[model samples]
Target: MTIRFPVLIALILALSAVGLTYEIAAGRVLAPFFGTSLLTWTTVIATVLGGFSLGSALGGIVAERPRAVALRNVRSALVATAVLMAVSPTLLGLLHSWGVRGTDGMMLSVILVFFPASVCVTLPSPLLAKLAIEARPGREGSSLGFVLAAGSVGAIFGAILAGFVTLPLIGSTATFAACGVAVLLCLPFVRGGQTGTPGTTIAAAVFVVFAGLAGTPACQYESGLSCLHVDRQGPEVRLVSDGTMQAAESTAPGEASDDGTVGLALSYTEWFWARMDRDLGPDPSVLFVGGGGYTLPTKLLASRPLAEAVAVEIDPLVTKVVRAHMPRAAEMIARTGFDAAEGDGAGRRLGIFHADGRVYLNETEQRFDAAVMDAFSSGSVPAHLVTREAFARLREIVEGPVYVNLLDRPDGPLARGVHAILRELYPHVEVVHGARTSTGRTNVLFAASRLPLAPLDSLPDRYSPARISDARAFTDDRGWVGHR
Candidate 1:
């Protein structure tokens, strides 16, 4: 059986799309456990590229075979690709449950779950190219060029569709299954792949459907920024973003404060508000760099009722998830008329702007009495948001002390680096933590101000001052990237 040039090129494009979709979705799937750090992305890219190179080598060997065998093997390879793509999510879950974590675990997970699928997806490309060449005999250079261009262009489409469309629309698990289905669909259109039995393809399709159905979804809502989910622990409702608990509040009777009022759940927010209470007046206008679950912003509006606050949350989906799932936060947003669409036009009590914190800071002319740098990507502050240049601009906009929340090992480089940068700009810079031991990762807060700050010795044995003596500062040119 002879394959048409157009049909063969279409197959190449579609398969390339599925392969790149798998690559992009791999990052999202690993994010919940591994925290989409620089290391995670680096590992995923390396593993995928290694697998593709190996598969292309194997495909070259298959291309040397008789046409019938080569085409038959391509069909079998596509079937394998479909199976692997569909089952990868479950495989990742199993690996994670077995205590797979850290750099080693991340590397292992990517190699085991994604690498084989990458290999299978590209294994048929050489064989398809051979068919394309045969269809147009002496136009070898043009045929190869078309194949190469189609594959590259298809990858671009897959990346855009996965990042902006499928992953956000249907979620990571479903997206993985869809990629498998996409590869399987290409099997029917391949003209020369004369497989005697359709039994394997049918079996693989059934298995992909079963795996998709049986797999538990990791997130309630997935956005380009983070995986959003809600969890209930007793009466406390917690909002998790990218496996990090962003916000929590008690809902049960008598679980509120002694005054019958609900307050902040996370300890860092309490520290932020404590500083705000000491420095700012009741009607103080505050700027929040990151609005995770909008917890602090909601609390500010509830307590002051008319406190003008703007929360620049990067992901609108995060705010949407909080409004739908977390009742307490939702009530405060509705009460304050905090519509993201209004964009500072209507509600001054609480304005919600969806944008990168640093970009918003650069663009806005509005000034505030104080600022809270509560924004984070996974466990660490986004590199640009933590740099010396970023803080220099922030100090200009915010009149009083600027509070920053970070997660790092006790006196880790990230903490020390950020502290070093802050010291260069502010007259008074201090690092404090609630943890007792100088070990492991803990929430470290940096309070930098033009004016002298009072000792944060309020809570029992909390806010222990950390010394920052010798450390390199993070700048826009040399930004912090990895998890410490």
Candidate 2:
């Protein structure tokens, strides 16, 4: 029943790795329902950490038992942990189906699905360490140190594995299953542990495999950045990322707008272009900060064949999906590595740069006739992209009017904060609403330029200039827009 010290250390490392993998992968698993917002990440992280803390406490009590009894419990815990981790994807899906939502529901679901498995994976660590110490009595310090070091090292390895390798390569469902199988595989290494029946082992293995195969994937295409999928909304195909519909375009054959351009499916897009047409000159050069589905840029290329449209999208996979799935987006342009700033006299051209919008703005020398701030991470605009410093850089690059699209509560802090900063840089700043005043979230647009924005005033539901004295401007250091 004796296990070597090196083998014991390796087992602890593997167990800790599995535990952390589950923690990191939980965000991607919850994204389809929660939108991967700051709130979702915060809740997931806290709940997992809470479970680990509770498990360590439980492990301390169990470690006080006799060596044989403690080791026996470790084997049992690992098997149970494996079963729980394997079933987590299914549990989350069922919870979501039953209408789990909002901050409270998110917390409840994480507690129910992720918390217990975290506890089980961690509960054996102390037990294993206790056995290791008892086996080599005089080497207690080094044994304890090695056990702790193994857990820490394993955690680091697991994080890198999930973020860079497995989650992106195999997707979240497979990653979760792999974590379970890893925990189960640790059973044999526990010194003095009871040997479970072959039937039990086979049953656990089958359940893990079934769970891996049973769950519907969160997206058609998943990347480190998002869970991306294409959805059909009547005749239009929409690109959805992390549960938020980023862009939509009409798929109906021969469908065209009154302006003889490809029809835009989203109302907010229609309103944005209508206002920008007045601000932007003929044969205009446009810069899109975020190219979700590339709907607006495609419309521009179709309507104004002479116009130049450059889109800087962060995730290449998203643009890839848009080209393959969305209507007309496929025929628009090939992704060639071109300098987005190099504006040689080309009659009509489209450039798609896969980089952070803010970073692209900072590095590019190309100035544009107009710019659109449409970049977002899930439901929230990435805080970095909306900072005052980012806007100031954008202002320098874009000479004509700049249009921004965002979702926030009607006249919410984010809308007001963006308005405040834009006003500081531009002489004329206006807010246009895509929806009537409501308690819930809605699309809000901010138009800013050095010149008078007369067109924005004509748009329906113009937000009356509110006293924004209390609205805190978002800076690079502190960008706290209200959480959706």
Candidate 3:
């Protein structure tokens, strides 16, 4: 019996949509463990493409077989893909629970979760092309065009729907499961690709049962941004992102001391107190760009009682989490009433604005005595912020000094490029790194100001700049992405 070309076309479209969704979701799935960085994207993309290529080759070889044989292969491929897609997030979740992290772990997760499914998804495209050739003999060119166009349209729809709707609503784990179920629905819509024999059915059932038992992507909280990785190692409550601990609190029964400095566990958090020689204007206002776990700002509120502070963090969920769970932040907010709204305004002691740092800086009239910029992830710095224009904007808004904590090598392109950009506006710019600092991230800080240099040795073990041969300044138009 001949197949309806239109039915095959529609199934192919659906398959294409799911294929792209899997590819996109793979990156997000691996982000919490791997970090949503260039390297991570590159790995996911490369692995996905490799699977597609492998499937295409296998499909091309099988397309020479009889029509009945082709349909059997297609049937098996679709069912296998559905099973794997359902389990991908669960597999990643298991790895996460096992404390697997970093590049190697991420690659392993991608290979296990994504590669096989991608290969299965691509198997049908070549088979569909050959089947169409038999259905309509001389319409080879049109068959190719129609199939390719349908695939593209469906992929676009899948990406948009997954990103804007499914992810924001049901979350990553459920989204993966739903996409799998969607692919299964297409089997009925297109005729002839029926379920295989009894043993195959039992095997599929067994996989489903096992996958269901793997549990949802394990996390304290999850969003399109990042997973809220909460860990209780001992007495400490930790919030980690990308295996880099953002904040930790000492919470234990019958805790003896209640000093303000207990939460400043990382050197980077303590570095917020390290200031320049020049005085901030009277009644000083300070700005913190990113409030990861609210550790630094909490420390500042407790230590610098006289200085008024303003923290602008983009993620409201993160702000909410810190205020609710973190002990020191909650206690400090309660004591000062800083977290409360003061007549449609932020508190004087510590005003919090949930907004992008650059946008907040551009709009706010309040000139800060100091600004702490902790926005950039170690692997992914926003292109716009690293430019000369951004530095200029900071120069205009900040009166005293602007301190930037960067996770870059002293001689790396990022450090040198940012150094050149800082020199564009500030008369005096100094880069320092501490050998044994509180921050375990091992980041370098760039102190940019329009004044003379202060005594560097005041802070113990501060690593001075190594050397600069021929550094280049990053501008808004020129140097956003190419710095690395």
Candidate 4:
């Protein structure tokens, strides 16, 4: 009896770990469709937790009669969850197929797919706990603690495994599938003594069909491919491929850019390079936070005097694409004898660090003269990168002026947000309008520095539009102001 209790406790812990892993995996699975945003992640987690809470409560009520009944309920819940987990992606895809794309679509999809699935999976926990206590009433506290500890350990493993193995190996969809399979494997163990209930079996089978249907691939729209992610406002679509966002476009069919650059278009590359040139000058030591297509790096090599360049991109797939597509940039680095190696001189002129930009910046002792924040897009600025706290950290590593690319509309809410942030961080800040296009609003560049900038009129001819005339000064308290 003692051995059985301990074993059951261990199984419960494993199941909890599986639950947590599936929640995270679900986020990644939805990233391609929704883009990994704070709201999206929050929705995923909240739905899972809510589902877990609902399931556990319901399971407790249903299992009140006997240990056998409780165990049966738990097993049924687990199986149902696995099946729902498998089917969610397909449902989201179907929603997309019906021309239902955008933030509202994504939020609704998550609620539909993730909420019930998580709730169903959550049913086992309370019942399992009750059973554990029933089996060994005297050691209830110890058993509960052990189960929780096991769950904590499993959660740690799940996070590590997702990062190192699942995501890198199988892609997001496959990772979710693998997690669903793990939960299904636990069903037989949890249902050890329980006879198959007809109603439970029917529900489980239905979920299985749903999962299979969800996993089936459907025809994805060409334009849809460009706006890889749908943000909540539902009107704006951020273009992403292989995890990294390339650009953003409107969702309205006619509202989108007819130009090639509208969806994953390379013209944004030229525009980005031009902005970099405008601010950083021809020759500048640059630190690029996110390497989208390595388009900017390639252009910098040709147009600017890049004394030293460092590209920190989180996604390996993006780096691979950059290497493949932007051969010239790679060749430049190779010729300059710049490699990933750490040291001084020409051999160390360029380095590509495949790590989180915030992590890399935090850890590196090296500083750059020009830190270009070109990574902002799709109404998402890595919270860490945009915060006043992060600006302070960047101030420590960067000696020269910092250039931030603002993708918000000239006077939109996003632009206001950027303006507010810049005001808090830098004493001297100015916004420069980049190329305007008919396809979308123009991109704006915000130049910030601790040092006082020359008056707008004093800037040379190269500083066209005159930073003073075109620029709006921002105060930490007042936000963007036309006059000082």
Candidate 5:
């Protein structure tokens, strides 16, 4: 009628491992919806720890019950948690497919998919501790410490296994289903927990496989780095990252106007010509620092055959998908690395490099006539790249105009702070508010150069003259845009 000390510690360890495994799986589940940003991670950590804090406190109270009753409750909690795990992937995947977008969608999905199981999985930890202490009455402190430490170590293992092994190798469905089955392993340790019947375990295993079959997450591509989602509305095909619309490309083709004005699907990209070398003449070697949809590069190459073009993208999977969408440019990316013969000398050619923008800029010997930075959106700009040191390096690599397209409000830290930094980095800085009305703006483009910028008038809806000055400019030590 007594539980063994080692067996009780093992059960507690399994319980903790299952808890952390589910947390990692929750991140993968939400990646296509919330993105894997600082904000998203903050939310995940809070949600998980919050549930555990509650469950552990309640488990302490449950420990006062008769041993048989507490063990029965532990078995029941494990079963319920596993059943929810089986259903979660399909349930959340369907929610995502039904148009879950932005922060609200992320919170809703987390509440549905993670909150219940997180609470259930930890209920047995304190209960296992109580059982162990009762079995070895004089060694209570050792029993508690050993059981608790065992749980923490198990969590560490679970996190590593999820990231480096299971999630990538088997995908989210099987990984989650496997975690659910692992949760059931703790049930055998429930004292008098089993009825000596295979019926329930057999049923749980079937449910795991069946739900896993239903659990394939909606994704354009789910890589170790990201989850991509593609959406099309009319001729505009947009690439979405972490639920945010990162870039848009129009399938509808158009030529330059009679006056030599270029056409583009996104107004932000169109702003590139507002003060760029491409406006003055041909064969200007241009570097595009972000490759979201490769829309800007595609636009540049199409508009000027003599334009030397290069796009540096961090995610090769994203690049590959967008390349398929832009076959000619994709062909160029695959065939060319850094230097290629200009297309018309025979022609100006484009080369793509799969590297981080900062690493590429620092490492590449080539100096660009102009450079475009569309690498980041508002909340998740790479902190290291937003600093003063990064801008100084960019100024070195780009001898002419450098245009930075930012999806931020004109007055926000990203637009305002970066605007201030550009003036210090380059002599002539012009802020082009791409989506501005008299009321406000959300997308701002910073054009800077050592030379004079071309005369540009504030056009209605297309672009307007804008500026912001503030005490905040990002540095490598300070960390990130939009963070105060």
Candidate 6:
């Protein structure tokens, strides 16, 4: 009886470890299609927790009878969970490809992956507890606590394994699969475990059918303004758009790009370089918050001696894609004056850190001469990146002048928002509207600094034909106020 209790505790711990690993892996897998936003993570966690609760409640009812029957139920539950976990990622990939873009698509995907998998996975604990209690006949509290503690210990190992070993080494999908396999392996060891039955066969067939439907490929259209490509790479349906790559499976690839550099208008990149050439002197140190095509980085190399240039991009895939497809950009980065790093690294003259620009600016002790807020676009502006609080953080990190690219038209939402935020944050801020092109919209340069604003007369003579217009003073509190 003593031995049986300990074995049940071990089984519970092992099942928990598998569950926690699966949760994190699921988040990474969904990130490419839905984005790695707080909303998406919240949905994933909530769904999983809800599933766990449901499974526990249901398992308790089923296991109220005999010890042997409960043990068999627990084994069945583990087997079911293993099957679901194995196929969840593939299912998510299909849903994402079926024209499911943005927040709505992401929420649905999370529900699909987490609901069934968590329900099956969570059943083992209660069933195991019932069996242990029936076998020992008394002292349920002490026995259950020991089992729960073991499960907690297993959870800690699972988290560590997912973060350090599984995620980094084999990638998310494989890690998830491994976790599922671990759960399946546990089934055979449980007391009263059955080998195969007609019911089990039917369940397996149902799982297979669902997996097939989920793994089926769907066609996608690409927008010419932004490059988009979809390919099945192993367990994931990889979507690469505008040099940014995301994996659509319950497991995220370690190389997925999280920074806000992809899908940006090419005109923004070109205009930014042109503006940099006009406003800043040659061989100056350049700090870029978002790294896209390395368009500006390459141009900086061509035009200047390249004293020092730092690009802080959060997405490793953007950096990787630029390096792979854009040789000129990569070469420019390799040149002595340029340093490419993720957004988290510290810097003086030049360094790259893979981190949030707002967070980095607030936390960084280093300062830059030319800090560019090249992080936003027309469709979506990262609100936090453009908030008054964010600008205050930028002010602390910048030593000289700050240049921000605003997606604006004659009267655009972005332009209005830029004007409002700038008015609140800077003592001296000026907007330089550029010419409209074939591309969707024109852009405005919002130049601001704590130092005296450079007068139009004192501004460099080489300003592009794009920048011919005089700086406009924006005094509206409501963003996009004039447009509405």
Worst 10 residues of 1 by lDDT: 339-348
Q: What does candidate 6 score in Cα RMSD to the true structure?
A: 9.6
lDDT of 3 by residue, 317-432 (tens): 66677777777777765665354223434435767777777787677777777777777542446666778888788888888788887665555677678888877788887776
lDDT of each: 0.83, 0.81, 0.70, 0.60, 0.71, 0.60
Output the TM-score of candidate 6: 0.70
Return the top candidate by lDDT.
1
Looking at candidate 3, the ten consecutive residues that score lowest on lDDT are 337-346
Q: Estimate each model's TM-score.
A: 0.95, 0.93, 0.82, 0.73, 0.81, 0.70
Q: Give residue 353's error in model 1 in angstroms.
A: 0.5
Candidate 4: lDDT of 178? 66
In model 2, where do residues sit more than 4 Å from their true spots? 258-260, 335-348, 436-439, 456-470
Model 4 clashes, total count: 7
Give per-residue CA lDDT, model 6, range 318-389, as digits (tens): 556555555445555554323334343243333556566667666767666677887631133345676666
lDDT of 1 by residue, 1-484 (tens): 7779999899999988998899999989987887878888888889998989999999999989987888888888999999999989889989999988777888999999999999999999998888888889889999999999999999999999999898888888988889988998998877664674778889999988877777787677787788977898988889887777777876777656543447667777788767776767778888989888777777777777557888999998988888887788788777774654455546448888889999998888989988999887876788899888898899889998888888886588888888888888888886777673333777788888899987654842455667766798999999998672
Which regions of candidate 1 fall more than 4 Å away from where they truly are?
193-196, 252-260, 340-348, 436-439, 460-463
Backbone steric clashes in candidate 1, count: 0
Stretches of candidate 3 above 4 Å error? 1-6, 89-113, 129-146, 193-195, 209-213, 216-218, 233-235, 249-263, 276-282, 303-308, 331-351, 359-366, 378-380, 436-441, 456-470, 477-484
Model 2 over residues 166-276: C-alpha lDDT tens digits?
Answer: 898989988888988898788767756556676887788888878778767767799888898888878889888887889998977677876565777887887777777
> Which of 3 and 6 is the better model by lDDT?
3
**Clashing residue pairs in candidate 5, if any?**
342-347, 343-346, 343-347, 343-348, 344-347
Q: How would you order the candidates by TM-score, starting with the best? A: 1, 2, 3, 5, 4, 6
Candidate 6 lDDT: 0.60
lDDT, model 6, position 203: 69
- As a whole number from 0 to 100, the lDDT of residue 67 in candidate 3 is 65
Say which candidate scores most in TM-score: 1
